[model samples]
Target: MADKSLSVYKYMCKYVVGTENHIKTIRLMNTFTDNLSSNNIKVTITSGSFGEGLQMVGSDLDIMLVDTTIDVHDEIKSIVFNPTQTNFALMTEDIKAGFAMLRFISSPNPAIRKICEKFKGSNYLSNALFKKSFLSELCPVLHGPCISDKSGHLDFAHCLHSKYWVTSASQWTMRSNNSWPNESTKQMIIKYGVLFVPIGSKGSNNEDLEWRMSFSVGEKFLIYTFSHTQLLVMHS
Candidate 1:
């Protein structure tokens, strides 16, 4: 057999989105949303090809859905965190408190800090809700809390949606930590610190106080992590 052209890969990378299967994946996730309505699961199409620039080539689509019905309080109780030790100073008390709650749930370890940062806006509501949100929506498209199984070594989600054989993966924002940062990234964060965006005041009582948030900084860095090839590979 002669060499099969890279044209195939190029073609796949080119029109990855709006493809038949991708459309079907959208429909399927929407269907999952509809079907699970009784279960009170709000399935938002999160952190996939469209969001992460990782749209790939096949009916075997990657879909992330946030199960809003889940209450993550117990998980937070188990996690060990000390906000006073965090290097995330230079922000407002309110902003700091929000990040502290996020750090409590998401960016506990310095090593995975970069990873955790990338998915921050996904849980932007978490910033507003603080401790109530946890790290459910943020993180990468493929990162989310794993739903347990009684069967074999499937640490991920698998299902047959419209006979398309959809394979899914997830990571929760909740994390267990016993330590803090001691690396270059930590140094940089401490020096530069988290930023805040002016989104206006909080309420009638506090019109003078503008609402500024630095939550998306993590996701911004996460977006940067995707190199050209990685973006193509992810989309593929």
Candidate 2:
């Protein structure tokens, strides 16, 4: 069975692993990263799956953006990932009715702290709308599709069909006690880099505070080093 399975893998060996495709993928990766850097986002971009030899034929090109802006004020060491802040507009007239109804209490989620839950929802909504319009303008020019793929960041049209391409932009520091980055974590950073992505989970509104952190970077290294056979098993 294993032998036959390996035989079926022949096609993958042809299309997925090769010098030409690898060069093309790397070139595109560099292009995308360079463009992103032009926006003043000081991040060291790393291709997660390709160079690692874990890329599948129809998989979206995975990219990790490590922010190098913030540093750990440990009064000791220093390190970091790319956490960017966008200027969000103030809350709307509708969300203000909350604090009283308990539906819109004063919280950071709504982005309005201290006094009330000013346009928190609106702020989030605005960010999405802004990105949509921005991608439409920038992505196509680079031949990089920013199409939505629920599983990842963007989508790609492989020889077979569509593939969800996920790109994580994060803030990973080499030195700090931010619960995620620290001295011990620096080695891992050197291996895969850092990312400050959404740090939330699936649950209730109160429990779902979608905080951002650095985790996938570590996993990238693990999968990157996994044996080719193991990687093939994952695809299986």
Candidate 3:
């Protein structure tokens, strides 16, 4: 019985669970594809289940386009003026957790300014306007934070890249947890920072101006650390 169970486990690991080398190869190929498809102003990242090196049957393709030209800062003082990049300060006060309002600070680009609306004498980036600009006849469906095709096979999330971590999720890095995700992993996640998806807090008055914070990059890293057994359990 023990021998049979061991053989079953080995079979599962090789076929269902996938070997370590197989997973690594998939990840490397995805990375190469992303690099080839990305540009200086925008970075294309393969996200969701496939990005984590797990490709299930009938899973849709998740793509994240991180706009590098825009910068999101936690505070106005922390923002260093860059002639080429547009800047926005994160407004988390009175907002729900995992969401923030982006107040337009400065922008060299007119196209960015065109999407912003002035509220109470301050220019604010409008989530509605931002998402609207991406809309057309081809991509009409809005799936939460992502824009999807008519078939829904592909999901593209246009995100603003931010170097600084949001204040609301800052506690996660310092939280007392001994078993999983060591200090090194935490530091690496922090260094990767965060991305702001063009979405809002539900039922909030400032929803139209709010953008939900995304930790997909960190999440991908964490998922990569999972053992074959753990991945098998999750897959199951």
Give the winner by TM-score: 3
Give per-model TM-scores. 0.24, 0.41, 0.90
Model 1 clash number: 14
Over the stretch 189-230, how does candidate 1's per-residue lDDT look in tens digits? 333333332222445232222223332323423543545555
The C-alpha lDDT values of all candidates are: 0.32, 0.35, 0.84
lDDT for predicted candidate 1 compared with the true structure: 0.32
Q: Give the TM-score ranking, best first.
A: 3, 2, 1
Off by over 4 Å in 2: 1-6, 15-40, 44-48, 71-136, 139-186, 189-194, 206-209
lDDT of 3 by residue, 1-236 (tens): 99998887777667565667777787898999999999998999999878888665678999999999998888677446787889888888887888888888888888888899887788899988898788778788888888899999989999997787777887887776684787788788899889999899888887888899899999988888888778877775
For residue 11, give model 2's deviation from the true position in Å: 3.5
Question: Model 1, 1: alpha-carbon shift in Å?
Answer: 14
Candidate number with greatest lDDT: 3
| Each prediction's RMSD to truth | 19.0, 12.0, 2.3
- Alpha-carbon deviation at 31 in model 2, angstroms: 12
Lowest summed lDDT across 10 adjacent residues in model 1 is found at 160-169
For residues 59-169, what per-residue lDDT tens digits would candidate 2 score against the true structure?
665544332322211111122322342211112122211100112212223232321222435213211221233344324321221233454544321100001111222
